[model samples]
Target: MPQFVRKNGFWGVRVNWVEHLNKKTVYRRKYKQGFKTKREASMWANKFLAKANSGELVEQKIPTFPDYFMQWARIYRFTHITEVTKNRYIVTASHLESYFGSKPLNKITRSNYQEFLNEYSKDHAPSSVNKTKGLIKSCLDSAVADGLIRVNFSLGSQATGNKKKKLVVIYPNVEQIENILNLALERRKPYYPSFYIIITAILTGMRLAEICGLTWDRIDVENRTFKIDRAYNHLATDKEHIFKTLKNESSYRTIRVSHNLISVLSELKVNGSNLVFAEKNNPYKVPYSNGVKHPLKKIIKDLDYNLGDFHFHSLRHCHVALLHHDGIDWYSISKRLGHENLTTTLKTYAYLVEEDKIKSDDLIETQLDNFLTIGEKIGETSKKHKIK
Candidate 1:
C-alpha cells in the first residue's frame, strides 16, 4: 500500500512492501521524497504499481529527441490539429531536429535548451525564434504528460536576439490605392486578372491565398455576396493545393462586394478554370505569390510610396484603415475582416483608432472655438443695447 505524506514542506510517498519469498515473515517500509505536489507523489506511486504489475518496473530505453518528436508527429498530431497546422508543426520540429536531434530526451536540460535557442536566434529573426520556441514547448509538454520527462525544459525560454522595434502598420491612402489599381489594370489588359485580384483584395481585405482561392461559383450576383469557405494553400507539399479550410474557423465567412466590383468580376468571367484568379497556363492551380508580387512591387516602386517593406497583406491593413477612417465601429470591422474576435481587430488596427481620435479632437476644438466667438459677439450686442 502507498499513501501520500508531507514533511518539511515537501510532498512524498510512503509505501509498505511485502517480502517476495515469505510475505508473513518480513515487511519493508520505503519512502520517496521531493515531489512538487501531493498529486505528483500519488501519480508516481500509481505508475510504480502499474509498471510493477506488468513485470517491468526498471528503467526502460529512452528514445532520442528527434525520434520521439517524429513518433509524436506520426502517431498523435494528425488526430488533433488541422492538416495545415500539423505540417507547420512538423516543419518547425524538423528545424529543431537539426540541432538537438541526436541527444536523448532526458539529457536536454533547461540550460541546454536555452543554449540551443541562443544559437538559433543568431541567424533567425526574433519572431521566427519565438515560434520555434513555442512549438518546442508544446512538444515537451506532451512529453511531460506522457511521463517521458519530469518537466518541460523548453518552458518559459525567451528568444535572445536583436529584436527590431515594432513597425507602425503601413497602408496606402485612398488615392495611392486607386493609382496602384489603375496601374495594374492598364498594364495587364485583355483579361485584366491582376486588376480583378487587386480590386478583390481592396474591397474584401482577404489574404493573398484567400484572394487566389476565390471562384466564380462562390459569387452570388443577385445577392452581391460571396462565401469564403476555404483558402488556397500554396505552401503545402504532402497535401493537395486548395485546402477546404481557411486560416481559422472565423475566417470562414460571407462578404458583400459592391455592385460595381461584382459587375467587373462578372464581365471577366470566362470559360476556364473555376478559380477567379487562376494561372493562365494551369487554370486549376492558383498563381504563385511571386507572380502577384512582382507586378505589385513595380507599381509601388513607380508610385514612390517608400513602402518597400510592405507586402500584399498591406492591402488588408489599408482596408481596415479605410473603414476606421470612415467611422465604422470596431465590431463591424472585425466581422468584415473575419477576425477571430474584437481583440484581434483592435490590436492589429489600434493605430488607425488613435489617428481617428486625433482627428476627432481637432474637430471638437474647432467647434468650441466657434462657440466662444459666437458667445463674445452676443455679449457685445447685449452691451450695446444696454441689456446686460
Candidate 2:
C-alpha cells in the first residue's frame, strides 16, 4: 500500500515493505517525491511496490570489499582449497582491507578498482597480480548475483606488474644429471634424507609435496610402481605434517619405477614408520621441502656444474628432459608427469621438445645419407656387369 501526501507544491508517495535479514523479518520503507500530480505519484508507487514484492530490488545494506570477500571465501572456497591456497585468499583479503579501507562494495567503481590493481601491480609479479584480480573478480561476481552491487569492478581491469619475470625452467643436462645422481648416491647417509629425496625426484618426476607425503603403502615393490594420491601440507597450521589430496585429479596417478630405484628404496630401513622418507629421529614427521635443498646445494657445489639456480624442483624438469631424450612421446611424458593434459606438458617443455626435434632431424638426415650411398653402390655394380 502507498500513502499519498502533499509537500510544498508537489505530490509524494511512501511505500512500505518487509524483507528478511539475517533470518529475521525486518520492515523497510522508501519515499518518492516531486511528482506533478497525485496520479503520477500513484503510478510510480505502484511500479516500486511491484518490484519490491517480486524481490527484484537491490540489497540496501552493502558490505565492504574485505567483508564480502572473506564471507564468500569461507562459504564457497575454504572447504576445498589447500592450506596454502587459503593463506593466499587471506592475504588477498588483507590487501583489500589495506586498499579499500571500509569502502562500501557498491561504491567501488571500475576505475577505482583498476587503479588499485595498477598500484598493487607496481610491486608484485604479473602472476600474483593476475591471481589477486581473479580472486576479487570472483568475489564481486557473487556480490552481483546477491544483488549487493550492479557490476563487478574487477571485470575489465587489467593486471599490470613491473616485477622482474621469473627465470626459465632450468634442468641439468644428461651428464650433469648423471653426476648429480652419482654424487647423491655416494653421499647418501641415514641422517641425510635429501639424497634419497633427490634420487626419487629425478626418477619419478614427483612434486616435492607428493614426495614428502608418500607412504610405504603407496609403493609396490613387487609391481615396481608407486601411487601418488596425496600431498603433504607443510603450510598447515593445525598439524605439523598434514596429508591432503593431490593438486588435481590428474595428480593422483601410478608411476612405474626402475629396478635400481626399487633396490635403493628397498634398502631403506623403515623404523616402524610407514613413511619412506621420514625424519631422522621423528619417524612420524616428514622433512620440509626447504630442508631438502641445503644438501642439494652442497652437491651441486661439489659437482661444480654451472647450472644456474638449481633446486629440488629442477630434478622434476630433469626427469622430463631424460624422457624426451629417450624418445618418449609427449602423451606418455604427460602421463608420467601426472599433468592435467598434454598441453600442460607441451607448454612447459616446449623448448626442450624443440631441441629434441632438431636431434630427430639430424638422425633422419643420417639415415637418408646411408640409403643414398647404398643405392649408388648398387648402380655402379649393375653398370660394371653390363659393360662386362
Candidate 3:
C-alpha cells in the first residue's frame, strides 16, 4: 500500500485512468472521506477495483421475485390449515404475483407497489387492500432477508376505517336495521339467504365466514352455545373457494348463543346437512339456492335500500355497536368475536361505532362531578372532627 499526494494536499490511495470519452487525465476518489490509514483505504480501493473488473464478468445472478416466492411457499406448509388464511393469502398474492412475478427482485420499486395498493383500494375497501398489501409486503421483506432482493420496497400499515376511500360505511340506525329486516321478510323473497344471514350476524357478531359455515353439530342447543370450527376461503391461484379449518386459533373458540340466533336456528330444519344454515342434499357454504349476491341485491332493490348493501358483515358491526352502547367491556366483546386480543377488536370496530359520543362523555363528566362533591364533603367532615 502507498499514499499519493493530491493537488489539494490530501493523502489517500488513488487510481488514475484516461477519460473514456475525452482522453483527458482523470482521477477516481475512493473512501478518502473516513479512512485515515492508506492500508485501510487501499483495502476498499482494491475491492472496488475487483468489482469493476470481475463483478460484471462473474454475473450478478439472482432469482426473480415470483421465483423466490414460489420457493418460499413451497417450503411453507400451506396444507392442512384453515381455508380463511389460504384464500386471504391467495387474494393477497394475486395482486403481487401478477405484477412482480416475472420481474427480478431488485427491480421492484416502491412506487410500483404503491400503485397496486392505490388501484386495488379504489374498488375494494381500504381494509381489503391493506390486508393484501400487508401480506405482499411481508413476502417481499422475506425476499430481502433471503438476499434475493436489494431492498424491501413494499410498505404496509393496518387498515384504518377513516383512511379507506372505497370503504362504504352505511350504518343504519337501529330503526333502519329493523326496517330492513322487516322489509326483507315482508317481500316474501324465497331466494334471499342473506336475510337470515344478516339476522344471525346482527344477533351474534360472528365474522362472515363463521356465519356462512355455521354447522348444526357445532351448535349446543342444551348448552345454549355454538362452536366455530371451519371457514370458507380461496387461494390466489385458486379459481374457486374451498372448505378449510377455522380462520385462526382465536376463531376456534365457542360463543354463547343469543336468544334471537338460537331461536332462528332451533326452527330451521336440521337434517343430514351438517350445516345449520345450508340445507341437505345440495349443501353449500351459505344456505339458500339463490346465493347472496343477486338474491340479496334483489331484496334490497325491492325495498329501495342502498344503505343495506353492506351484507352480512354490517350485521357484525351492528352487533359490536349494540354491545358497545350497552356498556359491554371490550374483553367480553373480543372473546365473543373470536379476536385473539382486545386490541384487535378495538382497532377493527372503533370506526364502526356511531358518532353518538355524547352518552359516554356525559356519563363520565357526571361521574367526575359526583366524585369531586363527595371528596369535598369528606374533607369538610375531617376538618370538623379535627382529624385532617
Q: What residue runs in model 2 are displaced by over 4 Å at the alpha carbon?
A: 1-20, 23-59, 163-165, 235-241, 361-388
Which stretches in model 1 have alpha-carbon errors above 4 Å?
1-59, 73-87, 164-169, 190-192, 235-243, 363-388
Candidate models: Cα lDDT each: 0.75, 0.85, 0.63
lDDT of 1 by residue, 108-175 (tens): 88988888788877777676677677767777888898888999998767676545633444677777
**Candidate 1, which ten residues in sequence have the lowest lDDT sum?**
17-26
In candidate 3 the C-alpha lDDT for residue 261 amounts to 59
- Between prediction 1 and prediction 2, the one with superior lDDT is 2
Candidate 3 weakest lDDT stretch, 10 residues? 233-242
Residue 108, model 2, lDDT? 86
> Would you estimate the TM-scores of all the predictions?
0.74, 0.80, 0.63
Candidate 2, after superposition: displacement of residue 217 in Å? 1.9
Residues 83-177, candidate 3: write the lDDT tens digits.
Answer: 44566765655666776667777876777766656666666765666666666677777887876677778754333332445546576666666
For model 2, name the residue pairs that clash.
Answer: none
